[model samples]
Target: GGEGGPNAGGERERRRGGRKDESDWWTRFQNDFPWDEKTTRNVVIGFAGMASAFLYFYFRETGKEVSWKDFVNNYLARGLVDRLEVVNKQYVRVIPVHGSYLWFNIGSVETFERNLELAQQEMGLDSTHRVPVIYGSKSDGTFLMSILPTLLLVGSLLFTMRQGPMAGGRGGGRGNPFSMGESKAKIMKDNIDVRFKDVAGCEEAKLEILEFVNFLKNPRQYQDLGAKIPKGAVLSGPPGTGKTLLAKATAGEANVPFITVNGSEFQEMFVGVGPARVRDMFAMARKNAPCILFIDEIDAVGRKRGRGNFGGQSEQENTLNQLLVEMDGFNTSTNVVVLAGTNRPDILDPALMRPGRFDRQIYIGPPDIKGRASIFKVHLRPLKLDSSIDSEALARKLAALTPGFTGADIANVCNEAALIAARYLNESIIVKHFEQAIERVIGGLEKKTQVLQAVEKTTVAYHEAGHAVVGWYLEHADPLLKVSIIPRGKGLGYAQYLPKEQHLFTREQLFDRMCMMLGGRVAEQVFFGKITTGAQDDLRKVTQSAYAQVVQFGMSEVVGQVSFELPRQGEMVMEKPYSEPTAQLIDQEVRSLIDAAFQRTHQLITEKRDVVEKVGRRLLEKEVLDKADILELLGPRPYEEKSTYEEFVEGTGAMEEDTSFPEGLRNWNKDQGMEESPQEQQRKQCLNTVSHA
Candidate 1:
């Protein structure tokens, strides 16, 4: 019995513990509903306003109207009527001798007035003492209601203004009326992994910029030696030559903030806005010290000033002035390096190119064969190549094939190759894919549906065959790669060639290029006895090349080693630096150069007439002929390699010659017989020579 009693007590205690747990949970659940002070205040304010409105409306609605008979008998008979008021001529407010005002629904003001007067007269009440029935009307707050709408409109206007251009938070630039002067430069401070190793080609440019990076990284080393860091560098090159990429790589290498802005970003519709933006950009660069400020297409804002009075001159001039001031301002100790890129260095303002501004002008031209190979290797790293492919050999082959190709063009070729492989459902990119990509990039997409007639096909075949044969036979001409008659791009035919990877060209080399360019026109004249519009582009190229050689290169004997070409201005305006007689001589020289090249082409094609016909026939049948097919049809070229690719790879082939002139001006001076004092010699070299790619 005692044990059972203990067990019953323990059971009761267990039930109490369960109940306590359940109560704790209930309390926590009730506390979980959040009610912060801010939320509570807002809720209370909302409820208070709603209640005030509700009570006011409820009290007004309680003023119910009495019956008309009751009003006349009880109120009028007892002389208890006090006054009456009208609201908007719609409803009447009736006032009794006692209690609150009651609403009297009436038909019209005239009827109500008539009824009131009759009742007053019947009751024998005077106008002054008989309840004093006032003729005043009740407005029912209509004026206040009318004014409420205007107040709402004003409030809306204020709200829209607050949320409009005056509101500053991102996207407040030229288009924003309130922030027209804000700088559009984008800041990149981190996550930039592009280093010098990733950027290919421009070896000379890379070496030139490496010192700047060292100056930034180890400034004390140079400062101790009393050498001031260069203020800026101007990257001048053709478009797509990797000028902008080199700047990015420099920033990455220096591990500093990169502030980039386009030159056109400074221009605005409003005056002084461009100058303001320039100031703001520099201020931002100053804030982030030891950073690189890269201005892409700087020529857009840095054009030669005072050329002419125009619409945008005032604003652009102010912008250029601000840029000049910022480049060499009093804040020179900030360690900020400015990098500007443009393809038209000739058109830039002279002040912008002077020392202490853009102190270094690095030229990044098209890559040579070895540089192109390195570029190919860099771009080919991520592509899924086939197992059998020799990447190094393929890179060399592509480099050899694509001359005058910039870094951007090579990257595009690599992407195009991958897309072609995917379209053909290949597992990996193959050599054929790369070959097709090169053709596509150089010539353009093949217009397969552009059908030609039999006569047109034969004419096109003969045209391409002429180019191939002429270029193959000429010693200094580019080697023929392939010839095609199938329509591609805007042309009816094309002949691809492998140009030598040479920077400096002699007069003989330029003449050979001109002769090869004229071959197609000569062929058309011989076969059809007339030339068509097909030679329009060919004629344009030959004409430009001949004029460059004469007017720019000083290759013409009549020019006497004097270059009469004027410096490039902003645009081609109506201006001639020379007299009418000199213009005639210039035209005559251009004509003579073209005539000589045409005669040479005619002679070459006339001698090889049978070979042209044979090559043309084969081109018409196959629609395309690669190097191997051309070699088989016309026999091997005079400069054919005695060893194969395997032999060369095995190091048993003939040694390659060094074509570069390391001695530069000295070698060129020796070739051309001229001697003068040092001062005059430098001027002559600068005057006669021009940069050619």
Candidate 2:
């Protein structure tokens, strides 16, 4: 019994080993056929088509094996044929004596009957041994043959449908014939980590949106007071002003899910697809209630509806109508808050910007001096700096340099500065790196290696000096910050100025600016005795300014306050908004303005010839001069203009309360003098020329 127990245990172990081998083999088989459900279905369909094709060819070929003469002579004569079937009376199948049936074609039922009887009688076969005749419908086989291609086509469509809309080819979502009008908006159930602190600048805009976030957080408080939380808010601003970032920050502040999409994504080339997508997007928003739906660049699909001229634009209009219904439709209680951003609000449909639809239109312009400083602070947080670098001073200087820079431009400047520092293998960023970054942003990189003839260099120096002198003399012109004779960007020479952040411009100021623009060309003619093509951009700007003052700004004497500017069009046509007489008058006015500006610039250069020559010689020697250097050569003017950044801190009284900055750096010291002793005498001569002007 003990021996029997041992044998049984061994046998059990063997059986278990066999089962393990089977399991391993099964797993290997599954691994070899590793495909997704869609791929597997396609493979099965392909194999089915191949099998059906093979069967069709096999049956078709086998039917033609025995000829009519051979069937009668070989099989029928020997009485080997047991039975005959006439299928649709076009083909006859003969049962063989020892194998499967054989088939032959005949003309018709009568012919087949006659032939079979003749063959049977010729063989002298009796009724029992004769091949019995039976008729078959053959309609089922014909039906399958006719429907095989349709079944394969339907199977192919099913395979394509299993794949997503992206696989629908180049047309993408809307181009695909099989798409079900699904929403293209991407859903983010998780809260975005960006907070309001991450978005710098646009403080007022932020404050406006903060209330909306609070409403989302504590809706019951507002609801109890019968105050409906705003259904929507539109963040209208120029590009790169942080509209999308504000939306993300708002989502983070409210701690709600975010569904973001572009307005263009809702439109497509197909009919009804755009509207369907709008409905689907709204349906998704409703399902994910208490969430934020942010649509970026809404102007793409929400332009004035009927203004679109193309056949496909009707689809976009349909989408806009659907969007309007979704935003402020009858389902008012839905918790989804819509946030749209656009750069061109003027192009939007009037109905789309109605009160209930976009309850608040938050305009986010470029940051002010104070706002820019805050933005710099936010961006500079991650950079490593030298101990000598003062962040406050650097921020103030950067804000001054970038008066019209958006948040994105500020970030780019910071990044460029870092890159410049890294290129020199420096451990920390310094003031010079930031200065280079500012130059790169405004005037582009310095082409130090570009060779210039001595005459050309002298001409450039005089040209830039001409601008400085004119700007220095004109009370309304911007103050000259720096002058450079070295080539940068497309210009052979350039002058940097500190333009005030003023919204309105007077006619005097416009005239003074135009004179400043013509300074270079006038100087070129005076110093070189001829003009060059270097002032092409300067001329272009002057022309535009003159035309704007005459035609667009309505600053002309004869044109009155009415603007004669033509309507904006995508195509070019030889048509003027005014009649021939008015057009001639406008042209004459523009030319008169340019000529007057040039004469004033020429006169100023002629009177200040001494200062121009002195400054031009210095620029030729140094190649570049900053504010202190320029002031050293030209002396103090009667008027001193401050940058917007300086005025902002001074007006707000924040300059006095700041403890981080050292005392001497608080204000611009006018005491810095040139190394030469003759600077004082030259300064007196410069003051005399400015007073005379």
Candidate 3:
């Protein structure tokens, strides 16, 4: 079957070829070169189309003579002959072009001969009619041939311009402006305006700082005396006590470079940044020797290291370590001093308080009376005060009003007084303004026009008047300064006392003070016939005074000469020093003492009923009183008495009566039963009757 199939296919092919159509060759050609396989075929097709156009043009120009020799000589022979000549000479020949182009045909006989000979030898062509060369000069086109080179040049120029300013290499040694981001420690050589004289009420601290300043200025003098200058001084004190001021004053007076930084600034979230900054700061300070580096509020970084509750310590520990090493490692001859200030000295690390580091701790405490006066004088210099305003008297009043106020507090008071005077349109700050300022500072701004009912006003007036009258009668009590029913701050009324400058108080003084405090309640019971809650403050004050006298001052008879008070340790709150049972006894003693004082006040007021009523009535009418009004109403104080007991007896006719008595007076009186009056005889008879029964 397979052998028959080949003969059958041959017979079919012969029959189909015998009956072939006119499109058979075209169809066979298209089958060989299909549309999908035309990528290489397209290039051949394009070249064929160009050749066809050229042939058609050549055929159309039939009258024109064609020179094949010229064509070959001008175009093909120019490249081929140069290569053949090199081959013949056994060396490659190099051709040079004038300017930017080569000249192939110059339209001259010599050029034709040279080209003709070259083409004859290279192409083996006789001098037959050759294709004529159609030579054209190189066209100078108006458009660019390639744009990549220009674009590259422009891009490079832009990059250079952008980098020039940033790299800082274009304009001399003016470095990159962005380099300033790295901050540096600034050591101030001048412009320290604060001096020791400007600081007030810190004489002891100032003296301590002055010694350090002197050491810095003349370290040789101290060295000659075998004294080592302190490595550092820590200014410890309550807030607003001029610690910072003293540090600045030392820097200014010593004429040294000063670097001021807060303790908190050395701490940061980044772990090692703090220590890095600490090293940088000290390095700068050392460069500027004879300098003072002041760290304000050092406790921010100097807290006792182990107390931190977090599992890991703060970065401030690293900073503190750096500070310690820098301070102790530096040579003493370098004259670089570290001054630190902290209100909380107790929480500082023990190592910081050692002999070589912070060797001296100067305490700046609250100002005393004299210090307050000096502080007032310094602050009052700028204020426009009235001529009649005596600073000493004002200072006395201020010292009494402010128990724990510091120098800064006094300055604040003076500023507030000036502001008050300005608010009232007064030309100068007066004593009244100063007083009001003190009240404002102590109790806060007064709530004016807190209107009360007539009954409440009467009660407040009587309540305050009671305190004043009792205090006036008690010799050991503070002298009454003023009593006011005008509502100020939280109180509806208040009574002020001219506090003495005494630092210590006697037992009698404490007793009199307690009685004076109880006077308000006593007056309420005596006049109103009932007590009111208006005596809440008075009772509290009396109770506290009595307890202080009995337990703290050891003034009570039951707890004689046994004080239970402990020394103050700053502002921290803690348990009482005394035991529970001792506290109970103290409480009982305090209550008994206060009760006795109240009884005494009640008796005294009852004895002077007329005087109490008079004072109360005047206070209610005026709503305020000065010391003059109190003195005029209560008469002179008991201490003002100059007369002795003998003088009193002689002046009262007692001595004359005694001298004139009869010699037999005693015998005669016994015989006539004259010794006993009728009242005495009745008392005797009653006693005898009771005894007989």
**Distance from true location, Cα of 356 in model 3, Å:** 1.8
lDDT of 2 at 330: 30
Of 2 and 3, which scores higher on lDDT?
2
TM agreement with the true structure for every prediction:
0.68, 0.72, 0.60
lDDT for each of the candidates?
A: 0.78, 0.79, 0.68
RMSD of each: 16.8, 16.3, 34.8
Model 1, 1-693: lDDT tens digits are: 474786888888899999999999888976995664335445755765675565456534357687666777777778676776676676666787788877667788888778877887888878776555444554345455457557656754554344333332222333433365668899897778787778877877876677676666567767788888889999999999999999888777666788999999988776666777787788888888888899999999999998775655577888899899988793446878899999999889999999989999999998766677789988999999999988888887787778789999999999999999999899999999998999999889898899899988888888888898998898888778788987888899978877655568999989999999898989988878988788889888898888788778888888667676744436574767777887788899899889999999999999999999999999989999998999898998876432222322344232221222233233223433435447657877887776431
Model 2 superposed RMSD (Cα): 16.3
Deviating ranges (above 4 Å) for candidate 1: 1-178, 310-313, 330-332, 566-570, 639-693
> Taking the tens digit of each residue's C-alpha lDDT, what string does model 3 give over 1-693?
374785888887887886685368768877996643134335645665575566555533232232545445454555432221121221212222221222222355455547656766677656553323332232222123244346546754444334332222222112222221111345677788876668777776776676667676667667887878788989999998989888777766667788888887766564555665566677667878888889899999888876645788667776778778877787778788888999999889999889898988889888765566567777887888789877666655565566567887888899999999999899998988888887777656666668889888877777787888888878888766678888777778777665654578887887888888888888888888888888888787777777777777777777678877644546554688777887788878877777788889999989987888888889878878887897888877775321222332334443211211132232323443345555556878999999999
Q: After superposition, how far is residue 330 of candidate 1 from its true place, in Å?
A: 4.6
Sorting all predicted structures by TM-score, with the top scorer first, yields: 2, 1, 3
Q: Candidate 2 regions off by >4 Å?
A: 1-180, 310-313, 330-332, 564-577, 652-693
